[model samples]
Target chain A: MESLLRVEDLNVRYKSYRGELKVLDDVSFEVKVREKVGLIGESGCGKTTLLKSILRILPPNSIIYKGKIFFKNIEIIKANKNEIFKIRRENIGMIFQDPMSALNPFFKVKDQLYDALRYSVHNIKSQQDLQQMIIKLLKEVALSDSERILESYPFELSGGMRQRVCIALALTRSNDLLLADEPTTNLDVTIQEQILNLLRELVNKRGLSIVLVSHALGMVKEFVDKIYVMYAGQIVETASTDKIFSEPLHPYTKLLLSAVPRLTGRWKAEGLIGRLPDYVNPPPGCRFYMRCQQSNSNCKIKPKLLKLNKDHSVACWLYGDEEH
Target chain B: MKSLIISNETIKFLLKRGGSIIFTLIGLSILIFILARILPGDPARMAAGWTAPDWVIEEMRRKLGLDQPLHIQYIRWLSDVLKGDLGFSIYTKRSVTVDVLQYLPKTLELIFVAELFSITGGILLGILAGAFPYRLPDNVVRVMSYIAISMPAFVWAIILQLMFARIIPLFPAGGQLSSHIVPPPRITGSIFIDSIISGRFDALIDCLWHTILPALSLSFGSMMQNARILRMGMTDIKGKDYMVLSDALGLPLRLKIYKYQFRPASIPAITAMGMSIGADLGNAFLVENVYNWPGFSRYGVTAMLNKDLNAIVAVVLVVGIVYAIANFIVDLIILSLDPRIRRMSRSV
Candidate 1:
């Protein structure tokens, strides 16, 4: 598989009224061809920030202090907003956490899809051409009532309907990479399943590389080829989904997986202890040192990601000593 | 029990707090009366002039009912108000309504012209600022709005009169019509409108020329506040994901800001016209005074100095009505624009 994106030594700092809060520090990852990479972690672990940095959509106050975000050999960090906007049309695409909010209230679904196609399809002369393109995209997203939905406002649609519209809009243009940030969090159980399945199918059928950002390891473990488990602002573990799920390396991953509610098991819900500490005045050394169940003397020392295998990595002192 | 809806719920909520309505009305009405009556010195005596005798002052007091019971006089005033008669103007000795109506057209005309700019032009500026978000133009507009808010209407009127009327001498300073020109036969009573209606092209031009200084002054503050509020509202809505969707879809930046952002942001400002319209009705004392425009501003100032209680009451009542109507329209617009209100309200 060829490398599609390479995020090297990425860092994001927010210059707030309070002080400079280092949100993302030295975070790096890569997505290979047709890869469904699941970024599983609690929010505020710099997952969403990493995604926004990819798109250059971070608010004005946020500063990218250090890093280079490379998209297909192009340095995204140096690109101006207009250049990024132009690039976003053909090279990348993103879906937000809340599907319902991902659409303009005043416009019809058809108009929204047409807007999405504006970056892809240039020189549209007639209304019928735009309509046909939108209808075709809607059909691809599996929305049967394309005509009616296109004419309706976003608020009028159901959650599943809106999510489908969002997905459809993203698919309107042939973008290289797809970034989904908790796309199914706002949906019902059945709808979440449907969206996840749809995303998996898109990745499988069309060879679309997706960066799936979510806390749900169980959901992504099924569809994603590789998994990156993040805590605080660093990736604690990176391994194939099968290896991560079957023989989880990091203590945090074990705890995170155990916390996932499951059926037909005597396993009781042992909630992860300790609160997310205030980002300002964060504890020195290892961020998870206070919360780690098996914290030893070496655990207090900040650890870099230690490569355990060609396909797996773990950022823990315990992993440093282990040969397996 | 009947089914509850948004409008019904809002009405019930408002009506339930019946005390607030009554209290507001009483407070306003009392303030109006006190403002009318207790200004500085003896008004009737002022009208009587410096050479008039003590006996004449006594006669004037009796005739005008200044010597009568204040409460009895207030009741009689309220009764006359109910009958739509504003009583006699102590200065002109004409019915206060007739005096107010004769001048209303002038003030309303200034308000009408200024309001056009405040509503249309001010909103357009706000939309431009909002569309760009953190752009340089947005920052410029933001700063300008603050400046607009800080400057008083009267000061602006004076400056305008000095620049355009006095020094530049491009336009006349005061009066609804040129004193040299024979006034067009009163068609709509408002000189500008009547002039336009009668196809008195010269009169129309003259009316506009005389109005410029005062209208510009009065509209300055309103335009700033409207733009600021509009910018704020637009900025907030811009943060919402729908805007991103619009951008993602590749909607024209112009269309997104003008059609989507401006309408939502301008709702409050649109409603604010009620207060400005009402304020315009009362007249800007400084603007009217500076331009020598014969609007309520001049009347109110003169009435205060002369202690013309009847004229003051007439002005206050008209001002209050204008204010109420402005707010009423704002409320209606708010209800229409926001669907959340429709769902949450117990009555529709």
Candidate 2:
């Protein structure tokens, strides 16, 4: 399958009052057409930064030191403003973490959707045509009260309902790739499950590609075909979801898997010990070296992401050629 | 049924706000009365003059009802106010209400023009500053607004009069119109409106030309205040997530500014406008005195200096009532603009 998006050797930095913070360090990932990929990490691991870099939505102070993001063979990092805007309008849709702040507060739902349609879709001719499209999109998101919902402001809706409206908005233009950045983080657990299931069903029905970013291993484990475990701004391991869950290669990945609580298991839950390395002046070699129990003098030099099997890749000395 | 419910809500809103305004006006009347009495010079003595004998001063005090107890005087003044009698101006010897009616329009006209200048100029400058913040245009606006805010209205009035009237010879230095031209027949009592109604184009031109310096001077502080408020609001709104959504969706810049940004950012500016109206009216006193403009503010100054009790009270009451009404209108506008406020009102 052809990849829909590819990010290569991406490094991002944020200039703060103290100094430059290295946010993303040589991160590389890919999403194939109609594939469900999950980016799993603890908070501040640069997962959201990676997603934003792909969309070119990083804050004004952030500097991209060296990186290349390609969407369907077009290098977005090198693209001009108009070209990037066209690509974002036509190809990519994003669902933010906080639905309340995502939508404009002063505008009615229908007005916001109308603005999206006028820019994204070219075939919209009249108000009636736009209204029909919005109604259909809302129904697809399982919101039956389309008319009332369209007239109401964003603040008037419940959190779950607002998120559904946001989902409907993302799907308005039939986007090829959807970036769900912790889409269920602000919702209740029951609503989170419903939204997850809804997303899974939509992806299957429409053959949509998605990159779901979350810190919850259990949530990402349920629907994603592939998972990338990131720690301190670097991808530690990438593998098929079942393979990673069954046997996590990187030590950080193993600790993460152990952290999840299971009802009937011999495993004793334990969190990864130690804080994230300060990004302003991170340590040389592996970012997780201070917390890794398997580190040796050989681990001082950073290990490259090396392929172990056809479908599994790990970036640690344990997975190096000498070990095999 | 919907219309009836809406009307009912309107009535309730009016009663609540109106009751508060009325209470405020009464409190203001009492305060102004006490303060006027506390002023050093006695109105009866001032009217009788220093050379007048004790019996003459006593006769003047009796005629003016100044010999009564303070509470009795307050009740008498309140009854007279309720009966539509504002009493007589000690200086002009005309009814206080009549004198106010003549001078009030001049001050109102000045305030109206000043407000027009400030609101339009301030909002535009604010939009420019906010849209390209930290850029050249924003830097220029910031420096200019700072200068405007720091200078008093009287200083601005003097500088403008010197520059435009004396040095540049562009406009008249003082007064509402040139002494040679007779004003148009009074309809609304505002020279601009009266001239337009009577179809006196020359008078209208002269009236507007004369207002240029005074109006600019009067509006400078308020303009700066409004610009600062709106710029702050817009800068804050620019960072909101919705703005990010707009950029990601590729919405046109003009549409984004007008539809998405301007309304929410303008709420603070609108509220500032209401508060500034009362302040501008007060500041008009100094501007009017500097320019020698015949307005209610000039009358107020004269009344206070000459110890004209009735005239002073009348001016204070009018200003208080105008301030209250301006706030009431602003509240309605806010209610319409913000749904949160409307919801709050409903709960109340």
Candidate 3:
């Protein structure tokens, strides 16, 4: 499978009043054509930051210290304004976590979608063409009553409906890649399921390559074909979703899976001990070393991501010899 | 747009606002009337001069209807006002309405131009400052706005006059027209409009030229206030989810600022600008005197000093009415700009 997107040894830092916080350190990731990739991590673990880095949309204070993000053959970090805009307009679509705020409140659904279409698609000029295209997009997102939905402001719609509209908006300009940053995180559990199902349907129907960033291991389990478990700004492990769930390898992944509440209700859910290390002056080794129960002298050196099999990779000293 | 303007909800909103404005104007009129009456100078005695006998003052008082009880006087004034009569101005020796019609439009023109300059300039500067926050542009805007906002309008008026009118000699020192130029025939009372309407382009140019110093002085403080408000709003909005989405979507910076970001950021600035209308008019008194532009505020000030009760009352009422109307328009604009407000209005 040819890679549609690739991140090479990406290092991102945020300069704050306190210090330069290393947000993403040596973070390498890849997505193949029509592939669904999931990035699982706790909050502030650079999940969203990684997604934004791919799109080159980091905040003003952020510095891409070392990295190369390639959407196809184009290096996003080196691309000019027009090139980046074209790529964002024609190739990439993003769905934010909060549907309530992702769409602009001041505009109606029709206007927002129309703005996207007008900017991204060149042939769309006449009002009639715009309206038809908007209706078609709305229908694609499973929103019936397209006319009423088009005229209504975002606040007038329910959370589910707003998410659907956001999906439609993202699809308006995007043809290939969908960067969904916890799109269902802010929704009700039922609505979350529906949005996930809709995203699945979109991937199947349109052959879209998606990078789903979420903290819910269970949610990502049923969504993506491959999962990359992230810990402290680096991908600690990557495997097929089933493989990762069945035989979790990374210490952090094992802790994360163990942390998920069980249906049996034996009261066995224990959270991972210790908070994330301070990124301003992070440890010069594996970030999870302090928290790892099996940490030894060798853990003082940062572990390289070693491929143990065709579909499994782990970045830990324990898996270092498994590659051979 | 038509639906938004003419909807039943909008009508209800307008009616409610109109009713409130009428009541507010009435209350304001009553307050000003009492304050004017209690002021040290007696209108009748002032009208008669200090050397006049007590009998002459009494006769003057009777003629001016000041001898009547307070309630009776208020009732009479209210009834006359309801009947479209503003009564006579002893200061101008004409009907109060005529004096207002002659003077008010000039002040309004100055205010209108000043407000236009301030609002447009403020929003642009605010966008500039906000886009490059904490950078050189932002720092420059911050310092300039601080300087503009710290000074009173009249001081700016004097300084502007000295700089532009005397030092540069680019604009006239004072007055509405050059002594040599023929005044445009007064159709709408505003010299600029009347000049344009009468095809006296020369007079129009001269009117704009004379207005520059006065308008600049009148605008700077409020303009800076608007800039500060819009700057703050834009900075605050920059962190909003929609703005992040806009950036991520790679919408052009211009479109993002003007279309996506501007409306939300401009709400507080618009509200501030509306309220500043009253302040601008009050400040215009000194500005008018400095320019000798023959505006309503100067007329009203002169009337107050001479205790011209009818003129003072009329001026205050006019100012109050204008302020209320300006705020009403601001509300309407905000209603259109924010759909959330529109939805609330519909629910109401």
DockQ of each: 0.33, 0.64, 0.68
Best-matching candidate per TM-score: 2
Using lDDT as the measure, the top candidate is 3
Question: What does the lDDT read for residue A56 in candidate 2?
Answer: 87
Weakest ten-residue segment in model 3 chain A by summed lDDT: A315-324
lDDT of 3 at A151: 86
Model 2 chain A: which ten-residue window has the lowest total lDDT? A166-175
Ranking by DockQ: 3, 2, 1
- Highest DockQ among the candidates is held by which one? 3
**Model 3, stretches more than 4 Å misplaced?**
A121-128, A265-268, A318-324, B2-5, B88-94, B196-199, B346-348
Of candidate 2 chain B, the 10-residue stretch with the lowest lDDT total is: B1-10
Off by over 4 Å in 1: A106-111, A122-125, A146-148, A276-285, A296-302, A320-324, B1-85, B128-148, B247-252, B280-283, B300-310, B328-348
What's the distance in Å from true for residue B114, model 3? 1.7
Question: All candidates: CA RMSD in angstroms?
Answer: 5.1, 2.5, 2.6
Tell me model 1's lDDT, rounded to 2 decimals: 0.75
